[model samples]
Target: MSRQEFLVDIVIALPSDLPPERRAELVAAESARARELRAAGSIQRIWRRPGQTANVGVWVAESATELHDLISSLPLFPWMSVRVGALARHPLEDDHQ
Candidate 1:
């Protein structure tokens, strides 16, 4: 079977009672992981949700199961309240390309 690509949108929120030091560690680790994923071409883009302790990104994966694995690998996964969405390509975007 052919592997299909998916676009995943994620939001991460840390617990208010979480320790600052732990937060720092998680952030650093998360950044490193994102870099690795980017290099591997699984992560396309990432941005911080301005004025909030959250982030959003576009990720490409073969399947939702693979995407879940990727997200769960994050160091902050345990502490995060996350929302994920699958995206479909727009006709306009294809025309533009």
Candidate 2:
């Protein structure tokens, strides 16, 4: 049995009025969780948007259900507004080699 790998693009938004200390705590926890996912090969890369509180990330999972589970497990999940997009390899890119 082969597991299909999916590329997921994620955008994360946090509430603007959250307390500074709480935000710090959440950031710390989220970073730790992200590290775990990276080590497990679930998360590929993450970047913070310039001049914004949002973040963008690339993730890989065997299925959408597994991806949802991973996102929902983040410590900051409760406070985040997230958007996810599934990506497919483009034919042009595939043929570039």
Candidate 3:
């Protein structure tokens, strides 16, 4: 089967007075989601900056719909605001050359 990929970037608008404990909890929950994705072998890599305003991750899936479903499965989906920068596939070498 051919590998599919998406490039996603998220920017978070953090709430004021967000406590450290709550932040930790949110992170823990997100980590669990990541673990699940890893177990399913769909996630390619995840890059996160806790103290910053954004996190980025790459996902490999069978289709774009699958990627959407995967993102919806994350706990952060409800409250966490995000902006998807780009969602596209890289050109195959044969196709490009």
Compare the candidates by TM-score and give the number of the best one.
1
Question: What C-alpha lDDT do the candidate models reach, one value each?
Answer: 0.77, 0.77, 0.73
- Tell me the RMSD of model 2 versus the true structure: 2.5
RMSD, one per candidate, in order:
2.2, 2.5, 3.9
Task: List model 2 lDDT by residue over 1-97, tens digit each.
Answer: 3344444444456778988998899989998998999899888777777876667777888777888899888888886677777776779997899
Give TM-scores for every candidate, taking all chains together and pairing residue i with residue i: 0.78, 0.76, 0.64
What would the per-residue lDDT of candidate 1 be over residues 6-68, giving only the tens digit for each residue? 545456668789789988888899889988888998888777778776777788888888888
Candidate 3 structure quality by residue, lDDT tens digits, 16-90: 687988877977887798799978877777788788866777778777777778887876676566554435555
Task: Check candidate 2 and list the clashing pairs.
Answer: none
lDDT for model 2:
0.77
**Model 3 global lDDT (CA atoms, 0 to 1):** 0.73
Sorted by TM-score (best first), the order is 1, 2, 3
